[model samples]
Target: MGPTGDGGGDGAGLVVIIVLAAAAVVSLLVAFGYYCYIRNKVSKHLNKLKRNNEALEKARSAVEEEEEGEVGPTVVTERGVQVFGFKQLHSATGGFAKANVVGNGSFGSVYRGVLPEGRKVAVKLMDRAGKQGDEEFKMEVELLTRLRCPHLLGLVGYCSDNGHRLLVYEYMANGGLQEHLYPDGGSCGGVSKLDWETRMRIALEAAKGLEYLHEHVNPPVIHRDFKSSNILLDRNFHAKVSDFGLAKLGSDKAGGHVSTRVLGTQGYVAPE
Candidate 1:
């Protein structure tokens, strides 16, 4: 009887130990599952935040691009002249560096620049304190926008921003006739001297340009500052009349002359 009782006690102890070990294992598995759930939740949250940040950045870039496209004011006229943004011109001329300077006049300086489309252009940067006033600037823009002739310089665009006035024109490779006629230690010195035939051709082209302005246009234009320096030549030696800041509008009637202030070069002015 004693042996049987002892055997029963031992069996009970073994059963208890086995149950406790099984409980410990079950607890460990539950803890591991909970940890995995929490880790997965945190990973999903981080991925959502990353996607939202990328979306926000894309939206900001779109707004910036829209603003860049709308830099200058809109023009209602259908003329060929474009209204350029100040920033675009600034970048084109390399911040208006001195090395890009092609010529200088009493009004301002001209710079050689390349447009974004790889087109070369001449940018005339008007001096704020120079002889040209706002009125003259407006007059030149108005006339150049309307006048279109083979022998006349073409107006590409203009910019009026932050009290800065600039005119954009087609690049004249050969420069002005004055440089060829009289070598004055200028950038156009490397150009060969003009022969008699070339000089006559230039004169004829200049005459044709003046005739178109005086006769063809309804309100005839009088280029008050016509001189050799104002006549630009292309690479092919084709002459084009430029610099219409002092241009005047004459009457359409016959024998009508528009009288204005006496403003022209000393030697080029006609005797009254």
Candidate 2:
């Protein structure tokens, strides 16, 4: 009887031990599942945050590019814009005084002025009541800023303030070709005779300048008022096409834009 009781007690103790071991394994599995769930949640959140950051960076870059392309002042800053101050123009043109007057036109007067750095320039004062007015001013400013040919006059600066408008350009020492072709005030003898070579050179240069204006820039530029008087001569007798108030730019196709008002001087106008 004693042996039977001892065997039964040992069996009961073995059963209890097996039950406790099973419970321990169950607890470990539950803890591992909870840890895995927490880790997965953290990983997903980090990935989402990273993607949002990339999108934000891209938006910022695009805005910067637009700003740089749009409102930038200098041509270098923006790709095509040129910005000049009113003060610089005033100082360069001798405050638009009468003593600096060099020539006059239907819409404006030209003045010869010297800059602080000893650079000589010609300033054209635009009349506020002119027919083209703001449109001509805008065209001249836009076209001159992009034009960089050796045969084209360089635009220095301009001023618009208190009903005053002006355009500044490089000074031409010999004046316009018209002066040499037809002298004013009965000074036919005052005009210089053109040799064959000089005449040919002038024609060739004029053609080349027009060709560049028609073919070079992104949008072709046409000098609607091209004539002998509009052609200026420098000290070295080099011809420079000037006065872009009547210029136009656009398509290569004809009939794209037709001017409402007649352009160019008499006898030089192209038949439309």
Candidate 3:
């Protein structure tokens, strides 16, 4: 009888040991996933000055090429990005009327415009001041024109005429994810509360966009300004990643690592 009691105690202790081992394994898997996520965040942020300086050079070269009307595949003119006539966009937006305005930000405003061909497009008009919004404009022009990820926002065209800067993209009917996620308690665009299934689907689509950038692209771009606001949705609630303004260009030389201060939204940056 005493031996049987001892055996039962041993069995109970074995069960506890197994449970502890299982918990340790789960913890390790969770840690590894987080590590991968941080790695995909492009590792380190580049110093503001360096980023700006390099951006200036890139934007300068691109602008110069556009100005010169260079041909062949090397020039942006020959690339997929169409050079929209400033007057056309001006007319489309009804002289940049406030009524057509759909969104506004530090760089400029976004207007819902209808192309002359009856195609609906979103036109981003950057208030050109001290070369203020040129870097972001050029970045989108350069990157979006080259990268063809389906989950990424499509650049329909752009206007860089007479010192005016405008970016035209395929209109996202549903607007940004942020709008739906946190409504103003009035005119909530999407369902009052996004069901778990819908939320998971949006997350999956966004991840696909990031995965394409992280693995498929030649140099592997890193979106430093990743957030819900940048994730736009279509009429069918399909998500597409937008806003390549603050993304990092990770080349072979850089090895996806840079040196500098932390960047991104206050609450969203590496909160691990």
Candidate 4:
């Protein structure tokens, strides 16, 4: 040993080394904690992003469901359903002239019209004489939009523009069952094309249509205006239920049902 002071200096250096080592360990621990914090944040952000993407996908699917088939609120396009313009229907029905009138009913006169794509259609211009109100017209459109059945009349489209309420329907080549069953003025007296077998078939098909509304649809639909004139026929005499001016949505199943008013054909009315 050189000097006693050298021992003191060595002791001081050892203590400094120990302190430095402790500081380094603490720094490493702090770095690890910061890394863990950053990782946790990134994981949370990813989870949130995943949830957002799932929500977006679900929304897209719901939109696709509503837009399924030919359903939209605009005309102009050749589709299974539409919301037509007043001008378009006016032109199609020859300005609602007398010549285009095919049949007259409690709602209004039915007119034959040809769409731009050469598609034959029947346009029923709701009578402005207060027989049909806005609520009834809107309800009919809403129900037809949701209701789709083979035996039930298909609502091709409608027009609620320019203070006018008109419904567009698929042109039934055979016309109304009434027209074929009981012809007026000319083809009177005898049995028309509707034979006994055909009449039975028509009756079955019509019942099926009504059954669909009663059992299939939720809350059920009441065709308050069920009648022979409301039954239309295809080219093959296949009957489909048409017209829903006085249709009503039923209440709870347990409570049965109540009619707000009696508005159907007097003779055809179901005697309560």
Best by TM-score: 1
- TM-score per prediction, in order, is 0.70, 0.63, 0.66, 0.67
Off by over 4 Å in 4: 1-80, 130-132, 185-188
| Whole-model alpha-carbon lDDT for candidate 4 | 0.83
What is the Cα root-mean-square deviation between model 3 and the actual structure?
A: 27.9
CA lDDT, every model vs. true structure: 0.87, 0.77, 0.82, 0.83
Candidate 3 lDDT over 1-272, as tens digits, reads 99999999999999999999999999999999999988766544445667889999988887676456442123246677667667778778788899988788777899998876788889999885765378888888889999998899999888888889999999999999888887773454545466788889899999999999988887888888888889999998899999887777776454557554566677779865
Instruction: Give the candidates in order of lDDT, highest first.
Output: 1, 4, 3, 2
Candidate 4's residue-wise lDDT over 18-103, tens digit each?
99999999999999999999999999999999999999998787567535522223543434478777777888888888998888
* Candidate 1 lDDT score at position 165: 93
| Over 4 Å off, model 1 | 1-77, 130-132, 185-192
Off by over 4 Å in 3: 1-77, 185-191, 253-256
Candidate order by TM-score, highest to lowest? 1, 4, 3, 2
Q: Is candidate 1 or candidate 3 better by lDDT?
A: 1
TM-score of candidate 2 to 2 decimals: 0.63
